[model samples]
Target: MHLLVCGGTGCRASASDSITESLKERLQEHNLQDEVQVVMTGCFGFCEKGPIVKVLPDNTFYTEVSPEDTREIVEEHLVKGRQVDRLLYQAPEGGRVKDSKHMDFYKKQIRIALRNCGFIDPESIDEYIARDGYFALGTALNEMEPRQVIDQIKESGLRGRGGGGFPAGLKWEFASKNEADQKYVVCNADEGDPGAFMDRSILEGDPHAVLEAMAICGYATGADKGLIYIRAEYPLAIKRLKIAIEQAREYGMLGESIFDSPFNFDIQLRYGAGAFVCGEETALIHSMEGERGEPTFKPPFPAESGYLGKPTNVNNVETYANVPVIINKGADWFSQIGTEKSTGTKVFALAGKVNNVGLIEVPMGTTLREVIFEIGGGIKGGKKFKAVQTGGPSGGCLTEEHLDTPIDFDNLLAVGSMMGSGGMIVLDEDDCMVSVAKFFLEFTVEESCGKCAPCRVGNKRMYELLERITQGKAEKKDLQRLNNMCHVIADTSLCGLGQTAPSPVLSTMKNFWNEYVAHVEDQRCPAGSCKDLMRYEIIPENCVGCTACARKCPVGAITGERKQVHEIDQDKCIKCGACLEACKFDAVTIK
Candidate 1:
């Protein structure tokens, strides 16, 4: 018997740390600690009801467990044989209480990429071993040939998950086919996309999963050393990774003579200093070698010449997570999961206006409707779904019209969006499309490595255009200029950073053109988002005033006598929303 508590970032924020500590203490007190091993695992997804707690053997999933309830869990379940009925997830539609397996969110997901994410304690090598960790490396070394392993991956139809969607096996073949004395295998764990935690979560939850997969990759590609280029901001992930590597070395998994095999493969960590542009392969390689994180033109490609000018193969965390599963299950079993072009599953950090926001891994061809409605539990506040911004800042927004579009590499590309590292941010009608575009552009401008002139200057200028539009300083010519810059940046930029920087602006302009037009032509923000176009006005009819608004205004913009209607000084108003909160009668209205 085992108890798994969600220790992922989201659950951590919700006080799962206390729950874990309390559960451990309570179990020890009850003296059932020997019978049921309590494990602090990573996210169980289903984040809406987090922090999640799962008991194995019976597989009883308890959602929203507070620290105080840890005693109840230990006493009732450990002492008695009765299952706690009230703690189980109450289905959104109020049906019978079911376990995690019966839930709709997990029903559609075939978790090839996230197989070990929620199930095992990342810090423990034994838990990882229970789930068949290091088995793939052992199998590869003992039974199979290196070329045969590569060929199996080639037949699996797996593509890269790091936005580019290149063929994974083909990329490996490129590195393997290249004859070099010193070769490299880099796990591109520097996941910099906003609202994307799939890579980070995998590293935090299942660091050994990546470690084993990278070893498999090293043996397949004829490489002996592996490097995980992870962002420095992921402190927990780095800690877990270090622990896993040390354990593997102690157990003869990472260092020389792994399971007494002739093949030698080991891994090291290179910390990336939070550069969004460094997510690019070449730039990541450059940063790893203590150079500036900037992308170079890809002619030689990472496979031919990467880290220290060696034959290299770089795949993101999600891509590598699938390698072990693909090898163990065979290419045919893996290929049957998704569409013809995109094989296996994709993990997405489903965030924004969605209710059940969490880490989800769905089959490749599943429609956005299913992801949004079935898995996500629909939009929050019952607001109408406006658009979904896929692929982070680089990828475009998809409107209601594109909801049914199957989520695959080529299909997403066909509609001006790419399945970028799977950061699916849902938006509702209240979210201004113009603001959304500007916000992404702002992020891109800040994160740009500024390697080339077009990306450096063009993206900043494009962001300026968006700023002007939102500020009502934009003209008709500005729209034409925005369109022109989009093409220029896309065509002339050095790498994917510059090339896809214009996606948000272009996507919004194409899908939400009317909103952009209103901002420019009418000089008004239709969605009431732009503060420059809005003023806090007192509703005299609803106001008892009572000097509350005047006293509460931080800027002293409001002036009023006792129990009199307040008048806001237009020049003094900063639109900080202080007066709106202070007014008891809902008198303050933004116009």
Candidate 2:
């Protein structure tokens, strides 16, 4: 029997390490340590109830487990074969889910890229092998030709998950067609999207799977050398990747001939400084060549001239992770799972305001409503769902109207959003759309490489306009100006990063125009998020005249005598809401 504990970063932060130690200690005390094996695996993806401990054979999933409960888990579940009642996942509606297979969170998810995660110990290469890990690489090298492998991928309809949605097979075919003495396969692991940890989690959980897929890519593209351009900030992912590479070499799977074939392949790591612009292919290529990470115009795509001026093929970590599974399962099987245009499953870092905050993988045709409401366990705190931001900073905000829309690349694009590296941030009723637009614009302004004037200047201008609107200082004409600038920037920008920077502003304007109008015309923030547009006042009827609000006012904005109604000086009020928090009688209110 194996006890798998969630070793992913989120669970680890929530004291999973202590839970593991406590479990081991308790198991040892009962002299059942030898009989039972406790393993620390990567993310289980159901992170809302994390520090997860799953018992094998029966597959009893224990959630939100603390160190104190470890003894009961061992004694009752491990020894007596009785499952812990309270630790089992309880649904939001009602009823306890003893089995993960029966849980709503895991029901719709089809784990292809995340197959090995939360199932195996990532450090152990043997564990990966036992799960048919290297079988795809071996099959490609031993039986299939380079062209045949490419054809299989083409038939599978696998598109890049990293923003562009370019066909993976076509990219390899393009690289294979280009004749060069040395070719390269580059894995873009420098994931820069805010609220996104999809690539990092994948690398941490299934490092060997990436290595195997890279090797397959090398054979298909006629590239002997491979490089993974990952961020320096991902220390745990880097460590695991290094270990996986070293182990693969030791097992004769990565270096020289693989599966006793004449093909030669090896992989190395290149560290990135976490530049958001580096998510762009050309900018990433420049960074790898020891130059400033700025995007260069592409007529000569990376397939023709890339990585020290050689024929190179670049694919993101998620894209490559799917290759092995597609190969092993065959194109027909994988293609049948998703929509006609989009094949296979997509992995998303499901975060922000959602009830179930974690990682999730669903078929390409899965509706946003299902992902946000059912799979994500609905909006956090039962708040009304306002909008959802897919595709990170570059993507647009999708409203309730787009709830039933299928989550494919083209579907998302049609709705003013794109599937940008699969970062889905859910926004609720309390979130201000104007403030949201301003937030994303701020990110783009900071992350813009500044090579293109449209992104560097136009984005800054857009941000300023959004700021002005949020502060209740903008004229109605400024709204039209903002719209025109967004179109110009999208039309003129050199790369995808710059082109999509105005998506948030445009999307919010389209969906929540009333909110923007309220900010400007009425000089009010509808969500009460913008401090400049907020006015704190004392409700005379509700006031008990306790002098609490008056004393707690930071700027002495509230003046009153004991047992008398308090009045707020709007000019003196900083809109800090300090008085509201201090008033036990609920006298202070926002105007």
Candidate 3:
């Protein structure tokens, strides 16, 4: 039996390394070192229950494993062939799940970009080779012409997974057609979405896959040099990528004349300062060229002139992760997976309000309901489902009406949201719509490159308007003004950062008009999330003459005699909810 422990950043932080060590020591003590192999692999995507330990042969998936559980795992599972009942993954429905494939969290997930992530030791090139890692690059370099390779990718119907669902094959063809002395292929690993780690996780888990795909892209685009512009914040991913690149070079896979062929391609790493705008191809190219990460107008698009003014093709990490797979697996095989328009799979960092918060990949046509209910294990704490925010800060909030909508590029766009690097944040009824809009606007406002007036001034203005609405200080007519300003920002913004900055406000206003109206017309926050819009009241009958709230009131907001019903002075109340928590009787309530 082989023991695979999650070595990804999340699991590692949770002491998965110590778990691996303990298991190894126990294995040696039991004289099963040679018979059983303990391998530390990448993330398993079920992050909520990590650090994960999956026993192969039977695929007995264990979760929330600590260093102390290592000996138990070895003695019970490895030696006696009995699974550790406590370590085994228990489903939300009160049953132990031995295999991950049977769990709701992974049942609907079709992992393509993340295929070898949790299964293989990413730093080992031989392990990567065993999984047919560089075969696609070798095939393209040896047998297939550049145009033919491009044609195959086009036929696969793969779209870029890095926010914009642009056709990947078409983008490559654009750079391929452009003739220049030197050309470049770029992997945009500078993922900056607030809760999105799709790109970073892919790099940390499957670095070799990205390298192979980059080499293939270099061959197809007639680019001799490849650069990965990853954020400096991802030290683990950066280290693993550096190791993977060095291994590829040593194996004669990355350098010139690979497979005894004339094709010469090598990859290098460029670090970014984690600017959100740099996710844009032009801005990324500019950052690589030692310029500010701000975006310039795209008349001379990155494909035409980029990175020192040469033909450069830029695709994000998840997009590149799919390239080798599509090349190895036939175009028809890949094209058949999803809908006609949007093909293949999308990797999502599923977070916020969901029970099974983790990294998940699903086919393009999978419904939001399937993702939320089945794959995500439904909303947390049995809370009423409110909305889901897709496409990161730039994407819009979607409601229950959109849950059944097929999750493709066009469908999400039609619903006032785009699939922006696959950050699906599920919202519950407790989440205030107006507050949610303000939150995303705040993020966009802060992350804006400030190069264009629309993103800089307009987004700040939009954020201010959202703030007014959330704080219950806005007029009803302010909604119309907010709507108008959002359109202006979308129409006039120089890049996507400004263009989609207003999406959250517009979408929330469209879906949760009543909530916004409550905050405005009634001067109340419906979800009680906005503290300024909430009034703390003491229930007259339920108070039971409790003095606890009065004593605990930090600002002397509550006033009453001892053993007497308490009353709150709204003027003194800071809306901290401390009185509510301090109340012994169920006396305090929010109005």
Each model's lDDT: 0.89, 0.91, 0.89
**How much is 288 displaced in model 2, in angstroms?**
0.5
> How good is model 3 by TM-score?
0.83
| Candidate 3, 44-161: lDDT as tens digits | 6565577889988888899999999988988988888888998888887978987866887665678899999889998899999899989998889888999999999999998998
Per-candidate TM-scores read: 0.83, 0.84, 0.83
TM-score, cand. 1 = 0.83
Candidate 2 global CA lDDT score: 0.91
In the predicted model 1, the residue pairs found to clash are none
Model 3 accuracy (lDDT, Cα): 0.89
After superposing candidate 1 on the true structure, give the runs of residues whose Cα lies further than 4 Å from its correct spot: 1-106, 562-564
lDDT of candidate 1 over 122-197, digit per residue (tens): 9999999999887888888899998889999999999999999999999999999898999999999889889999
Model 1 RMSD, rounded to 1 decimal: 7.9
* Number of the top-ranking candidate, with lDDT as the measure: 2
lDDT of 2 by residue, 1-591 (tens): 999998866577789999989899999999998999999996676665787999897888899999999999999998888899999999888889888777877767899999988899999999999999899999999899999999999999999988899999999999999999999999999999999988999999999989998899999999999999999999999999999999999999988878999999999999999999998888999999999999999969999999999999999999999999989999999999889999999999898887678898999989998888767766766578899999988999999999999999999999999999999999998899999999999999999989889999999999999999988999999999999999999999999888999999999999999999999899998888899998888889999899988888888888989999999998888888889899898878887
